[model samples]
Target: MLLAASTQRTIGLVILAIVVLGGIVYIYFNIRSARNEVGSEIELASNRKPYLSDEDLEGKKLDLALGSSLVLLTIVAITLPLYWLGEPGRHEGRDLDTWRISTNRGEEIYLEGAQCVNCHGPEGAGGVVNTAITSSSGEFVAQVNWKAPALNTLMSRHTEDEILHVLNYGRNGVMPAWGSGGGGPLTDQQLEEIIFYLRSVQISEDEIRSQVDSGVEAGAKALILETSDEAWAVEVRAAEAAQADAAMAVRLLGRADFDFECSDDASECLALDEANARLTAANEAAVEPLDAAVSTWFDQVSAAKATADALVIEADPSLADEGNEDDLRAAALEILSTLDAFEGQEAYLQWGEILFSNTAAAGTYSCARCHTYGWSFDGASDYVLEENGRDGPIPELADGYVTAGGFFGPNLTGGSTLSQFETAIGQSAFITRGQAIGQTYGRGGSGGNGQMPGFGALTEANPVGPGMGPGSGIVFEYPALLTDEQIDAIVAFERTL
Candidate 1:
């Protein structure tokens, strides 16, 4: 009975399978007919090619599947290593904290612990890299010099904002902009972190002040030695005497006695000749004293210069050290401050003023041109006064304005007013040369844009401005223009503005 039941079950299963197979066959035939019609329509296209046979299609599909799998495997292999390498866990070399921070790309963009040590010397002291730098005095003085300014003093000398500006804009063409303007290779957060790091390492103000005092003392001693140099004094006196003698001789020669034969009257000529003879005698007498004075002065200047050179050599190493940078800067400030103590010492003011005024005059406009009393001409100002006498319009001063070119000039009323006498005689030399007189002074010509001409050279726009001679429209350029000394003096006075 069991064998008979098994046979019956098998027969039923076979019948069910047959029905399913028949349905599948019907559906496959109908799909094939539809595909044929579609294939024919597609083949009518101008660019259509012959369709692949079943065997060809199967081989192509096999190849595609293998290629796709290989590609996917390759991508996975590449990404896995990259992800692993970038992971913080894989970083093993430096100060973990610094490494984490630097690699973070979130807070700051700096090298991690060991990396920092590699470029920046230990203790965050700066190291030399091949970089072009500009001097604070606006001269292209040095390039890729191994002498790197220490970074430790940056905090004491500059505010955070100012520091950011310097980092972003760079200095003296030597320092490359390292912030946003420098392509923002790092995020803003990274810059701030670096700033924080710098702040953490800054020397105290007291230390800076002390160093400055020492520098000033050294400078003062040098100055005294210069002033007391008898030999230099003698040379200067001699030069002065010679110059005076030459002038007097020329004057005497100009008299009636020296008149040209073109003169119409012999009596006038005779009278002139007599006058000339008397003048010549007087000049000869004056020559001796003038020569003596000039000789003495030159000798004094030479001796003083030598003393100054020696003092500078001694002071330079001390001033340049990261430990003493504050003091050096302070010394410079102190020197500037002393200008007020020596009120009648026009020379000091003249020197300072030339640096200040030329920085502004080298550009198109200055802080004073717009802000008036609100801004100081020596690049110092506290308030931005309004056009209405209280609050001023927003200043459009860009980084370039402060260091290269500006639309306005600075005001110097906060300190001391420059006497016209000093301006006339002190800054004359600088004015005549048309050279930008300070580290921040701009180039003279309008930078490439024809609409604006440079202030240094003769331009159609500025025919009579500083450095330019009288306009061509004038009958004759002044035969003998103001001397450079006179121009420098004028610039000095302008600084007192």
Candidate 2:
């Protein structure tokens, strides 16, 4: 049994008390004995009155003293060994306590000191940052609400060291460098504390799969809903065109044009008047219909998301209530297995496409962020087209990407994955376990830099698991980033890409 700190302290106090009381009793007896025997007043203290001769004194007296010393030595030998035996456990407890304290401090900083919860969401559920995008030469582009990735599943894709590196140097210019190395406020230890907090928030394998499935389902339904409102689409287009015209008009006016209350025959005054009228008319026209369309669209999107969320819950209500993940995973997998096409190229392929392009969890469930150029800040974000003209840095893409023609990762266009894996199973496996630095994967796929993240339960080198909470200890489970069926769907989509 582990000795609690309280119990240890109590034991120490008892031992000290015993030592103090024993000293007190010994002193009391010594004082009483020091009164000098009544018969020794006239004698040479006790020395003259001693009855034991040299022979008797050398016999039992010496033996008794020697025996007492031996007994005390035996106690010392026994107690020393026993104390040593408990030392290791005490040290382990101390270590555990230290980590626990560090985790608590880190959490405090995340929630309060650093206030990371503002953009990253409570418990690292993921959220958004409202900011403006800009051009290379410092021109304003558009207002954007960028999605911040969830830290709940972060360890599965990266190790503590890697996560620390990100904290030190930041990523994408969106997350500021928090560590001193990157010239921000935090020290290396503070960054490490953040990692410790992140470890604790990571969701379990079942929860990870559930989150992934939820996002996938949401994406799938959203894509179908993408074209459901043709009338709304038309209204949206009109608003966009009006917005562009307004922007162009605003651009046409020069600073000098507004300097004077224009002369009646001035060309500059006429041009300014025309531009202002165009801008006013455009705003009035675009605002109403677009607002109505936006409202209707949000309602539909919410309903779609709700429908997707209910799928797994409806599949196994008993499992859901009991929180039996193993069974729930089976039920989820059962649902997933039936998603493949009963008709043409398979319905799973649609799910796969959506999953690949999913924007949920800051595209944690999506591949486009890494595989498609400009996907991060492009029309993937909510933009104010009115503020931006047709010349916005990232316009709404026609079909959203060359559908993974590839950017950061190797292009899988033209049946590239087919040649690399030769079978869907092999590709699925590769995506599941992911790549390690200096470790190769597939046929001739060079693993230089080893950035391919695992989609399944990762262990060993990866931070893995929801490493947080009381009594969970430090050994974190490798998080399963995606289910087997989900990986298969993505693989199926990749083969086509």
Candidate closest to the true structure, highest lDDT: 2
* Clash totals, every prediction: 89, 3
What is the alpha-carbon RMSD of candidate 2 to the true structure?
10.6
**Could you tell me every candidate's TM-score relative to the true structure?**
0.27, 0.60
Off by over 4 Å in 2: 1-51, 54-71, 112-115, 136-139, 179-185, 227-343, 374-382, 387-400, 407-411, 419-422, 443-450, 461-475
- Write model 2 residue lDDT over 310-365, tens digit each, in one string: 57677556766666765555444333334342233344566677778777777776
Which tens-of-lDDT digit does each residue in 1-497 have in candidate 1?
23443555565456555645765797699668764223334334667766776567668797799779867865664565445443433332333465345335322334562143344444445554444323345543222323233454444323344556656765434345666766635445566667645544554445434443343333333333334345444444454455445444444454434554424354544554555565555446545554565455345433433343344446565665668644553343333333342223344443333333222211111212232321222222211221113232224321212321222222334332243123232223223323221222132222221211111222122222112234423221111122222233334334444
Q: Over 4 Å off in model 1, which ranges? A: 1-150, 225-227, 230-497
Model 2 scores a C-alpha lDDT of: 0.65
Best by TM-score: 2
lDDT of 1 at 309: 33
TM-score computed on alpha carbons, candidate 2: 0.60
The deviation in Å at residue 490 for candidate 1 is 18
